[model samples]
Target: MANSEPGLADFTKHLRKWFETRQLSSETDYSEKLWIDIHTLFQVLAKGIDSTNPFSEAVCEPDNPAWTLRSHAAEFKVCQRIVNIFLFMDGLHYVNNGDWQQRYIFNNEQRLEEYLRCMLGHVALLQLYGDNCDHIELVRTVSNSMDPFREAFRHADISKTCANMNYRNIQIGTKLIGLTMARWMEQLKGTRHVGSITSDKPVQICNQGQGTNTKEATADGVRQNGHMPIVEMMEDGTTDVVKKLIKKGKDMTDEVKKRLIETVKDSTNPEKTMEDILDTVSKCTAPGNACVQSALESVHTSVTPVPPNPADHDPSAISASA
Candidate 1:
């Protein structure tokens, strides 16, 4: 069920029109790259959804099956599209300076959110349709696909607003995918024969020598090697944690600096400790912090709003008028 040429063309045309309506197409370089990425994402998703068949090899060997391979590849493609959308949105935000509604067509954020919700829903539905059929491999494939996107988003120098929105969406999508897999595994376990013994089940071991049991042998081996406890063994763990904290602090430094400068200009607080300063900075710089956003909103409302450009029509309104 791979997408045909006409279908692909129609999808691309629709996307192009959407971008054009939003005035995004006015920027030649941005629009060209955006359209290419969108087209690729649409093609990948269409092909993957069409070609996936989780039941093709239902009775094959437990370890590997024809369906597993096809489904895994398809799911990976779906995940790639998810990540592409995020990166594309980040790129758009990087070049544009405005609120979400100002930057894109009306309802664009809602549309993207709906699309992600539907994609996650489709994956859950696919697993449900399999009826307790094992798709652990597919689940693993989808989970692993998220790593690259996570790393990219983690390090991307994007606004807190954009980052928080996309990050929450990605997190939700992955959690849904994981829950679907968990449900599938639960169903599979429920259907298994009562007498079955899984490979993970502990086995009875006879003492071979020195009256040593398996548990005792394991302890003895650890003691002989002078292995520290798990937490203590992680010598670099504390250093890693501190480094992450410092990185987070550095990332917020600009906002913190702005707040500090503002405070100094206003001379609101004459005396404050380092702890108090940090606490104030943390409150001000935290993503989506209610206090900071509320203050900004008040300031924003005090200014006269500029009318939206007539050329930038709302896509939803345009559709309704048509």
Candidate 2:
């Protein structure tokens, strides 16, 4: 069955009516800092239905019990509704830059913080005692809704040193308890992490720390070994050369290829071997190929002579010779 619960709009209207009845104004500056009557609000929440109390009737059922031992689920829903009311108030205060007429609703920063912490404690208790998945889901939803209030309270002031200490303790205790309860639930459901087994291997428990250690070892080994073998280093180099040759081959125009072949055929040295032609082609195609350039220079020096140029002679001597 669909939940017939009151949504945010219903809660907002109810809260606004309550504020209006109490003559709370967002514009009022209560510098004297009168404490917001939180107990009165609780009493209003507890009150069931009456023609005189329209807000209560609109927000909750006619016979709704605020604190009930009969049904934990019912009580949890009540608490959730209450928390939502506070969340709405907090949002209003935030959006208006703390200028809401209901700003006086919280007597001071400390009061507001205490109120938020109290609600958080209530929600945590509900979560601890929750019986079913639906109850747990409601608890989670309420917790999420109240997160902003908790964050705001974190930065709020505490008037007394002891109050501040107690607040911090409460916050820590609630977190630890929530986590412990969740872990207990996981274990109860047998949903906690378990080791895995493969066909050939024994059961191996997955450990994040172990994985991290393995990664560290690999990184440290690489750092310690400054260089790899020449052959291993040249693996990527050879791959790059093949890729570059393929790309150049694809992009080489038919005209360009013909011109290269003609140049090779018209070589001055008739005895120039196929190897020499290939070396020259490599150098011409890839001027940045260091290996090809070195090889060609070595071959040229070994096979070819350095011819004397007449231009290298003194100009006057060349003229007289002529």
Candidate 3:
């Protein structure tokens, strides 16, 4: 049966209360934030649904919970529906800026750095509904890209007298790094995207760091999913996307650094920005075999340039004679 009444999204707030009352977690800040983000995304989608198309009719709600989203058109729709909710919530400012890096969600003083860290990490959870965990890697890779931003937070001069939020906020930094765990697992599921980039160019890669350490040796690097998609298999792999997006007029900034780092963090909370992310990216050295732009550029240049010919000798010309 369809949820005819469309149970109010207040479900998020109530869920948090339930967790809190049982002392499962002290306060439901993380869970409540998810509710807020999902609800916000739903409202946005709801408007589009009412004005143009009804989602309920197009997207089926299957009774099977174990089925992968790819199993059926309806399942994927529902999965994408849930993913869209999170994307809309997290995208409020960056989406408006026309570039992912322009928004400074975390740099301001007088902020809840740790709480925001938790929230960013929680956003990764949005992958749970998908047929692909590549999104998990996508999220983690995005988080790693924002490491420099978190590093900025870690090294940022907080007041000596700033009150502690009951524990050392180092949790935020570790939490940001912990995003790689999801990335590793996400890679197991893999990802795929279809687009055109023959005319695309690589955005100029810059060293935003004044020089700082964000985390211990880890796999993620400065390039958020914005710069490069993780575990890709392109004609040139991650290098191609970076080159294309850059050519498309993408800009780089410290805030972009922050968002990239945050992307790898958890998706438990949908709206919060973690400061340690800036600091972490600033500090951590590239993990084993990590591919930064410079590396990609080197490989791109080393490939023997193919001469243009009218023969069209590759697979395109493979007719019945093949």
Q: Where is model 3 more than 4 Å wrong at Cα? A: 1-71, 91-322
Q: Where is model 1 more than 4 Å wrong at Cα?
A: 1-40, 46-132, 152-313, 317-322
lDDT of 3 by residue, 55-111 (tens): 222222322345454655443443343333233223322232233321223233113
The lDDT of each candidate is 0.30, 0.30, 0.28
Clashes of 2: 4
Candidate 2 TM-score, C-alpha based: 0.21
Q: What digit string (tens of lDDT, one per residue) describes model 1 on residues 1-322? A: 0123342233334544655645443444444544354344333333333232222122122323443445464434333332332333323222223222112222454344333333322333232222211222232233234334335445331211111111111111112122222233234334421112122212123123557654455335434532111111112122222222233344444564344324322232212322243333344535433433333333311122335446532221111000
Question: What local lDDT does model 2 show for residue 140?
Answer: 38
Give the per-residue lDDT of model 2 (tens digit) for 72-127. Answer: 54443444444433333232233333422223334334334344333333322222
Q: In order, how many clashes per candidate?
A: 0, 4, 49
RMSD of 1: 20.3
Superposition-based RMSD of candidate 2 using all C-alpha atoms, in angstroms: 34.4
Give the TM-scores of the predictions, in the order they appear.
Answer: 0.20, 0.21, 0.20
Q: Sort by TM-score, best first: what order? A: 2, 3, 1
Per-candidate Cα RMSD to the true structure, in Å, reads 20.3, 34.4, 24.4
